[model samples]
Target: MGRGRGGEREREERKRREEEEREEEEEERREKEERREKEERREREKRERERRGGETGGEEEKRKREREKRRRDRRRGGEEEEREREEERRRDRRRDRRKREEEERQEERRKREREYKRRGERGEREEEREK
Candidate 1:
């Protein structure tokens, strides 16, 4: 009877220890699942933030392109103005050249008229001397 009681006590102690070990394993599993859940949540939030940032960056890039387009348009307008000014300068130079040629022609004509008058006076004086 004493031996039988001792054996029963030993069995009870072993069972309690097994139960405690199982409880500890269950707690560890719960903790691991909680940690995994938290990590997943953090990753999800990070992805959302990254997506939001990417969207914002795309919008900013679009805005920059628009600004660049406007700048290019303005530069094109300035180039057109410069071309027009160059055309106007060319026209002015042509007009000045024409005016200069007309002035020179008129001066030459005056000199020829003066020379003809002087030659006529010399001829009349020589005819009188010969007579």
Candidate 2:
């Protein structure tokens, strides 16, 4: 109803329109930047492929196969190493068992020698008493 009130409403409407326009412009700028970046990435990849002597479908497949082969070779190498380690452990265990058996044999021989010495002494004492 009053001029002052109308003027205030008009100013608020203008501010709202300006904010919307700013937001739209910012959105357009962001979209353009994204498109440019995507194009640049494509160009870079194309150049790389060209530099590598034109990776056609056959070349790509060959490279893929080579990569797979390398991976298999590496896995095989790891398995071989694991097998070698297992073999070494087994050898150590066998050596320890052999050593223990040898020690037991030596102890048994000593016990037999002690028993023979005691029997010889007893026989000599018996012979002297009979004389």
Candidate 3:
């Protein structure tokens, strides 16, 4: 009976150690799973941040392009306005020159008419003195 009791006690002790070892292994497995989950979450968050930054960079580039286009258009408009003003000034100069020429021509015509009238009057006086 003493030997049987010793054997039974040893069996119970072995069973308890086995159960404790299994519990420890299970706890380690749970810890590993938690670590893996945390790592996966961190990777997902990093990816999201990178994607958001890329989108912001794209938007900034688009805004810069729009501003450059607006500046180019404004420059072109200013050049066109300057050209129009220059053309108008040239037209005004031409009109002034034409008017001056017209006045000179009228003055010459009046002088010629007055000289012809004086010659006619002198010829009439000579004819009356001879008669």
Candidate 4:
């Protein structure tokens, strides 16, 4: 009974705030729906493009490009493998040369030992005859 005009003003202000809130909610819902629709449309378009590509032998073209790249890579790999084989051959040659040199050195040492043994036997024989 006492609050007449003040109550009316308060009611009007509350109603305005609620209406603004409802509008914001509606805008957010619309934005979400629009984003979903856009995403669906993009997916549909991508599928259609893929189907068209299949029909036009675009997949074959892609495969051809891939094959060409693999062929190039294999060619390069073959060159690298040849280089590696050449290096291995060089290493083997060096190893064989070292082995031959070592054998020659050992033979020289055996010859020297034989000569020294012969000289020692000759000296012993001479000493025994003197005794």
- The candidate scoring highest on TM-score is 2
User: Listing every candidate in turn, what is its Cα RMSD in Å to the true structure after a full C-alpha superposition?
Assistant: 51.1, 38.2, 53.3, 40.3
List, residue by residue over 1-131, the lDDT tens digit for candidate 4: 74696578658856865765686576568657866976896698578658757676666867875786688588768856875775576567557656865875797689789989999999999999999
* Model 3 residue 43 lDDT score: 89
| lDDT against the true structure, each candidate | 0.72, 0.72, 0.71, 0.72
Over 4 Å off, model 1: 1-62
Give stretches of model 3 more than 4 Å off: 1-61
lDDT of 3 by residue, 4-71 (tens): 97678659856865765686576568657866976886688578657766775677767875796698
Candidate 2 segments exceeding 4 Å error: 1-57
lDDT of 2 at 94: 56
lDDT of 1 by residue, 1-131 (tens): 66797678659856865765686576568657866976896698578667766775677766875796698689769866975775576567557656855775797688688889999999999999999
Q: Over the stretch 9-31, how does candidate 2's per-residue lDDT look in tens digits?
A: 65985686576568657656865
**Model 4 TM-score, 2 decimals:** 0.45
Better of 2 and 4 by TM-score: 2
